[model samples]
Target: MKRILIIATDGFEQSELEQPKKLLEEAGAETVVASLETGTIKGWEDGDWGSDVQVETTVDKVSADDFDGLLLPGGQINPDVLRLNDTVIDLIKSFDKQDKPIAAICHAPWLLIEAGLVDGKVVTAWPSVRTDLKNAGGDVIDRKVAVDGNLITSRNPDDIPAFTEALIDAVKIPAENVVEHI
Candidate 1:
């Protein structure tokens, strides 16, 4: 079975994380949620605190080699904070180094930029993050989903379906065979 590692922390976009996880599982993949700390992490929804998801493990305890892909659900706060952690950045870099699928939506691309994986890559993200991605040398587009090499990115919650589908496809096929966009 394909195993996906979902990394997030307090303030993740509720639907971005939950919907993709549900769809991935339904598509026959196993997902493990890792956070900055133990226990559960809260989500951000509609300008307020939303649901909580259990943290199966901490980021520092996981490795890119153990999972088939990485899922990064974004919220204004989630990626903003996660990007500052060295451990989180290192983990993201590890995934990129292994050429594994790294699916990031909305502001989650901020983490990708921080990990220095955006250069020369085609990607999409929340509008506010487009400038950042461009500044980081990424070919930013306004599509619902964009895939460049092993990096997959989406714009926002509304693009969750396409984003999730892209990730599932990437996981089910060899990296070189994955589609470029959706």
Candidate 2:
């Protein structure tokens, strides 16, 4: 079975995290939510504080080697706060270094930029983030889903379906053959 590590924290976009996670589970992939804290993290939905999701583990307690892919759910506050965290950045870098599928949507790409994984990579993110992606040396596009190497990115919650599909496909492929499949 494929194991996917989902990284999120307070203010994560509710649908962005919940929808894809539900879809991934229905697709037969096991997912674990890791956060900066051990309790529940609140989500943001429709301009207000949304539901809470239980945190399965803390980010520092997990390793990239143990998961087939990484899923980063984005909300302006979630990625903004997480990008400032060194441990979170290092974990993202480890996933990239190991050539594992690192799927990030919406503002989540901000974390990718922090991890220094955007250089020369084709990616997409919420409109407000395109400039940052470009500045980080990423080939920013307006597509719903952009797959470069083992990196999978999407523009926003509206793109979650395609985004999740890409991640699942990438997870099912062997590391060495990921690029070819994309």
Candidate 3:
């Protein structure tokens, strides 16, 4: 089974993280919630504190080689705080170096910018961050989901369906001579 690493901190968008996690888990992928620290992380739902998701592994304890993909669930405060962490940014860079699938939603793409992985890539994020993303050299769009190379991005919670589907396809694409692009 493929393993996916979800890097998040407190204030993650509840649906963006929980929905895809449920889908990935049902598809038989092992999902690890990697946070800045262990214990429980809070979620943001409809502009309020939602639920809590347990952190399975801290960022310092995770190795990029052990996972098949990375996920970033966004919330206003979630990615804001994450972008300030050097270690978290380094981890994001490590996943990019490995060419592993990395998905970011809502404000989560902020970390992508901080990690220096947005240049020349097509992605979509919460409208509020469009300027920041463009300044970082990314082609920004308003689509529900955008898939470029090994990166998957979505605009918001409403886009979770397409976002989840894109991620599922990312892992399901047979690793062969086949050049199927997502």
TM-scores, one per candidate: 0.94, 0.94, 0.93
Colliding pairs, model 3 = none
lDDT of candidate 1 over 1-182, digit per residue (tens): 89999999999999999998888877778899999999999999999999999999999999999999999999999999999999999999999999999999999999999999999999999999999999999999999999999999999988988998888888884444333333
Q: Which ranges of candidate 3 are over 4 A from the true structure?
A: 173-182
How accurate locally is residue 169 in candidate 2, as Cα lDDT from 0 to 100? 88
lDDT (10s digit) by residue, model 3, range 35-136: 988899999888799999999989999988999999999999999999998888988899899999999999999999999888999999999998899999
Q: Which lDDT values do the candidates have, in the order given?
A: 0.92, 0.93, 0.88
Off by over 4 Å in 1: 173-182
Q: How far does residue 114 in candidate 1 sit from its true spot (Å)? A: 0.3
Instruction: State each model's C-alpha RMSD to the native.
Output: 3.4, 4.0, 3.8
* Tens-digit lDDT string for candidate 2 (1-182): 79999999999999999988887887778899999999999999999999999999999999999999999999999999999999999999999989999999999999999999999999999999999999999999899899999999999988888898899889984444332212
Task: Itemize residue pairs with steric clashes in candidate 2.
Answer: none
Q: Which window of ten consecutive residues has the lowest lDDT sum in model 1?
A: 173-182
Count clashes in each candidate, considering only residues at least 3 apart in sequence or on different chains.
Answer: 0, 0, 0
lDDT of 2 at 15: 96
Candidate 1 lDDT at 13 equals: 97
